[model samples]
Target chain A: MARVAIQHEDFDLSNEIAELRRHDKRVGAVCSFVGTVRGREEGTHGPPVLSMELEHYPGMTEKAIEAMIDEALHRFDIFGVRIIHRVGLLAPGDQIVLVAVTSAHRGQSYQACEFLMDYLKTQAPFWKKERTPQGEQWVDARVSDDAAAARWGIPGGNG
Target chain B: MKIAVRYFASIREAIGQGGETVETRAETLAALRDELIARGEPHAGALARGKSVRMAIDQVMSDEAAALREGAEVAFFPPVTGG
Candidate 1:
């Protein structure tokens, strides 16, 4: 089984790990990735970021992420998975994303963790707008993200 | 039909508005884009050649050929760089 959550508050990694491992005794390893709000908005075509406002289409975001996790489970042999993404006003150093996957071995866990992050990077509908010292600006979407999602052969990543 | 049009980034600044609803008879996204391009210098200039623009209809990524129904929300933005 897998757990996917998109929240506006911070999360406890230890708690999520314990929850994922509670029933799955065969889980021998866990792999995780946390995306933080960086001080600089890389690849943006505008001013530096003072702050960023994140927006997402409510029902669709969760559904898309769940489908992505489902695909990850089908492609990789993993025991459990958990994804936590935060929305709303986020400042630099704030934890914005979390991905965790567990498997009997570290290999599968690592692959699954990477796969989930890649999928979220391109597939998720969230958008970010940064407020720079010069002026407020919206960040441009990256083409590399599309290429990253293409590795999985999923559609709609080209955006 | 009345469709709410939203703009972001340089386009928003160039146009001096965040979003607005517009009445149009265009039945497809392509026609709507053309209509927007013809609006004025700001709209025309912002959407001019070599611009890296992306669009979403009702919050989903959409192409120029995507069908436009009545009252759909359309958004135009520059490329997204968020992770």
Candidate 2:
């Protein structure tokens, strides 16, 4: 099974795990990644991250992420996958994103977990702006993120 | 045709509004942008040359030459940095 959601609401980890394992008995390992709002700035002063305003291209964002999830499913021997991404105004320490994958063993689980995150960072069509003491500024996409995606041999792909 | 044009982040601040409907004979995304830039100094300064920006025509990725029709929604924003 494959699950993808672009939500403004928070999700329960245990419930997501349960949903992933509902029908599968051969699953032996479940790997997941949780993205949270951190306090420090990307590269500047460690400002208190009051909040982050996330704006996405709606339909385009969901389609792009769904495609990445499909790629992850194909590249690894995973049995199931789930991705939930939050949008709108989010405060610091709030859960921003989640990626969970399950498979017969740990190797596939770990690899899929890392791969999904790397791809999502570079290929998802979502934008984030941070609120600091100075003002709000748009976050710049990292070149290293592109490099990370390139290491996977997926060519000409960027959000 | 009249279309809703939306701007976000820096572009929004520069234009002082989220969006507005404009009537145009322009037929492509590039032409629409040129129309916006001709609106005044704010549009000209914000969407100036070499800015890292992307366009969406009715919620899909679009290029400068993407065709436009009646009642389309055109959105403009900087390159996404969300994780």
Instruction: Please name the candidate that would achieve the greatest TM-score relative to the true structure.
Output: 2
Please provide TM-scores computed only on chain A for all of the candidate models, following their numbering.
Answer: 0.90, 0.92
Report the C-alpha lDDT of model 2 over A1-159, residue by residue, as the tens digit: 448898999989999999998889999999999998887766875677788988876677788888887898899999999999999999988999999999999999999988888888876777788998887877777777777778787532343
Q: How many backbone clashes does candidate 2 have?
A: 0
Off by over 4 Å in 1: A40-50, A131-133, A154-159, B1-22, B41-49, B71-73
Q: What is residue A29's positional error in candidate 1, in angstroms?
A: 3.0
lDDT (tens digit, per residue) of candidate 1 on A1-159: 348777788988888888888987899999989888878756776455667787765655687788878889999999788888888899888888888898999999998888887778776767787787887656666667777767777543345
Give the chain B TM-score for each candidate: 0.91, 0.92
Clashing pairs in 1: A50-A131, A140-B79, A140-B80, A140-B81, A141-B79, A141-B80, A141-B81, A142-B80
lDDT of all the models against the reference?
Answer: 0.78, 0.83
Among all candidates shown, the one with the greatest lDDT: 2
